[model samples]
Target: MRIYGPSGTTIGSPAGNTKRSGSTGFSLPDDAASTQATRPAAAPKAAANIDALLALQGIEEDPVERRKRSVQRGKGALDVLDDLKLGLLAGNFDASTVGRLREAAANLKASSGDPGLDAVLSEIELRVEVELAKAGQF
Candidate 1:
């Protein structure tokens, strides 16, 4: 089998040895200098604006990470509920556990951007509210 290359070309020819067929030169139009002269200089950015922009960038949270955090919070709330149950069964219930449950309920209010997880979290929040209401601590 034979492999063919362009006419007037050889397999081992150096790129520098290639023949030029056009001017290959670049030139700007006559109005290029006038356009550049007419353009306005960029204004300097304020320090306060730069600081605010940086702070806003830091404030943006990743969706997946936010979802994971929500799930963990839901699990934490569930664990607290289980503890509450065990405490009741053992006659060792305390006020701190209810306070933690209230905090968890508040944390569960933030959306996790996942439909299923948000639904589950809402259910957990509902249960927490119910427990808090029953204890008259809500």
Candidate 2:
């Protein structure tokens, strides 16, 4: 008869008691039993305290300063778009198309203020589509 493991993989044969074999490929030495006898017993789990958890809720502070610091930090959307334009022109496009895309992006930046970067990106995407269409890439 076959004995299967938890995942249904067959482990070994289960025949007569004298012929029964476990999964261990090698025989254990007689000294192995003595080595296991001296191991320390595992410690019991600690009980949870509801009062300690409730006390932690009162210690937490508000985050007004962190919000102000984040608002002041880092480049805004226009800076990122300018960088992307530079990368695109440097990678594949000719000078005339890159120039027109850059001019449209600048116009978009001036008109839309902070939110205009999205429009600028959209303009660049349109320019790429037009170029790709010219080359029959799309």
The prediction achieving the highest TM-score against the true structure is 1
What candidate 2 gets wrong by more than 4 Å, as runs, is 1-28, 31-114
Candidate 1, 83-124: lDDT as tens digits:
999989999878999999999999899899899999999999
Error of 2 at 114 (Å): 4.5
Question: How many pairs of residues collide in model 2?
Answer: 0
- Best lDDT among the predictions, by candidate number: 1
Error of 1 at 125 (Å): 0.3
TM-score of 1: 0.57
In model 2, state the lDDT of residue 15: 30
Model 1 root-mean-square deviation: 14.8
Q: Provide the lowest-lDDT 10-residue window in model 2.
A: 68-77
